[model samples]
Target: MRQEITSYLSTIKNEMYQLTKFLYDNPEESFKEKKAQDYITKLLLDKGFTVLKNYMDIPTAFHAQIGEGHPKICFICEYDGDIKKGHIYGNNLSTSISITAAISLAKVVSKISGSVIVIGTPGELNGGSKITMCKQGAFEDIDAILISKPHIYNIENPKCPAILPLKIVFEDNLSGNLTSMDAYIMTINLLCQLAKGFKPGCTIENFSISDKVCVISLKAPSFDTAAEIRHQIEILTNTLGELIGLNHEVTLAELPCAEIKTCKTLNRLFAHNLKECGIIELETDKCVTSGSTLGCISNTIPCVNSYISILKDKSIPYPSSEFAKETLSEYAQEIGLKAAQALAFTGLDLMEKQNLIIEAKSELIVQSN
Candidate 1:
């Protein structure tokens, strides 16, 4: 079965490459990936998967599926690009890999008693589309979720921190003396001081600031810690406003993202498949974290969000023009194909073995608690 999967993916490598190149050539931003959505859905439809466009009331999102019954494996596809760097984060490669895996798995799903679902989740850069879909129960029936990302090294089970983005507004109502910038600076100082005492690993960044408002992000190892941090920040902001004679408002900038709960059962399966695909040197020592919306889905279902190295040079930082260019290179195409093969292999394993899904779900239950 593995050999058959490999041979089948090898034949469709060109098609996968074409999809990646097309997405690279025409990059689209979050929630505006019309071209990408149309192209991918059309391709999936042509491949005989029953596709539901405009999934969960999101125009750019779609759900494509094949086969039926237990152990329904889901492949998440994120094609939204960065606003400035355009596919610099390798979303094009990730989407292509997901589509390739789903299509390849569909070829053999008839022989098994499982299903394969390809979910087109857009707005990963800004809108948190997956989070919205989770609220809408998009992944209610999924047994396991698999996604691969392009990175500087091949990694398994990277830590993704729970993130909370907020907009803080300071209004000088009494004396009109305290400017918003002053409030922002003061808040930053307080947050820095507070962070020193936080037990859980956390980070706070002020991403955007204007005359009257500043947008800050909080990341923590878990949602409980993140919410605690938010609570502390709110109290501090209110105290500071009172002391400075200013009015303040704190609002959520986006949906709060949950930390990834990687299923050990799934990770082991994916690692075995990755090694079978000739990826021997896996990086598991370094601690890596991402603010991806996929973390939201992983919080509920068993998931494996692995990484495939797209750049040979480790110094080229991600979300840069150079990294974006590397995503279009032949090396990236090869890596993407391998990742797809590994994902499909893992999906096949889950389909053929119900015990694996049961173990993965049990792991998820324990980890999520």
Candidate 2:
């Protein structure tokens, strides 16, 4: 079965490259991936998968299925790229790998009593469409979710910290006590002081200040801690506002991203498949971190966000033109194809082994608790 899947992916490697190149050349911003959605859905339809566009009322999102019954395995595809730098984050390659994996699994799904689903999740760069989909019950029935990203090293699972984006507005009191700018400067000083008392594993990741608004991103080891930090900041800011005769508004800038809850059973299977593909040097550090919307889905279902090496030079920073161009290189394309083959092999195993699915779900329940 592994050989069959490998052969099938090899046969379509050129087509996959072309697909990646097309997405790389024509980058679409988040929530506006009409061209990408059309191209991918047309290809999936031609390959015999039943695809439903406008998924969950998201115009750029789609759901495609190729099998039926229990142990419904899902592969998540993200195609939205950076607005200015194009496919600088390698979403184009990730999307190609996901589609190829699903197609390869579709070939052998008939032999097993399982289903394969490919979900096109857009707006990961800014809006986090997966969070909205998860809220709408998009992943309620999925047994396992598989997704991968281009990284500097081959890793089975990377620790993704919980993050909360907050917006603080300081409105003038009109009593001439102090201007909003004065309040903003005071708030920044107070926030810096407050940050010194934060517990270990918590930090202020980034922040920005405008004329009357300040946006701060808080990061913590867990979602609960992140929310607690946000609460503390709000209280402190409101108190300062009251003392200075300034009205303040605190609100969430976007959805809070939860830290990834890895399903060990699924990650082990994926690691095994990756090793079979000659990717034997896997990074084992749990502290290696990256941000991802997969954290949203992993909170409910078993999920694995594996990493494949896409950059030949390690020092090239991401979101740069050089990084974007690297994604279209031959080496990156081959790595992406290998990742797709590994992901499809993992899917094949999960479909054939019912106990694996049961164990994975059991782990999810225990982890959630």
Task: Write model 2 residue lDDT over 1-369, tens digit each, in one string.
Answer: 778887888799888988899999889999999999999999899888999999999999999998888779899989998777898778898999999999999988888888899999999888579999999999999988999888777878888888888888988777676888888788888888999999887888567887678888888878899889888988998898778888888898888788888888988999998988877888853655446777878877888798888887999886677887888889998889889988998888888887898898899889878
Q: Estimate each model's TM-score.
A: 0.96, 0.97
Q: Which residue segments of model 2 deviate by more than 4 Å?
A: none
- Kindly report which residue pairs in candidate 2 clash with one another: none
Best by TM-score: 2
Model 1: CA > 4 A from native: 174-176
| Candidate 1 whole-model C-alpha lDDT, 0 to 1 | 0.87
lDDT tens readout by residue for model 1, 76-171: 999988766779888988999999999999989988888899999988888569988998899999999999999998888887788899889887
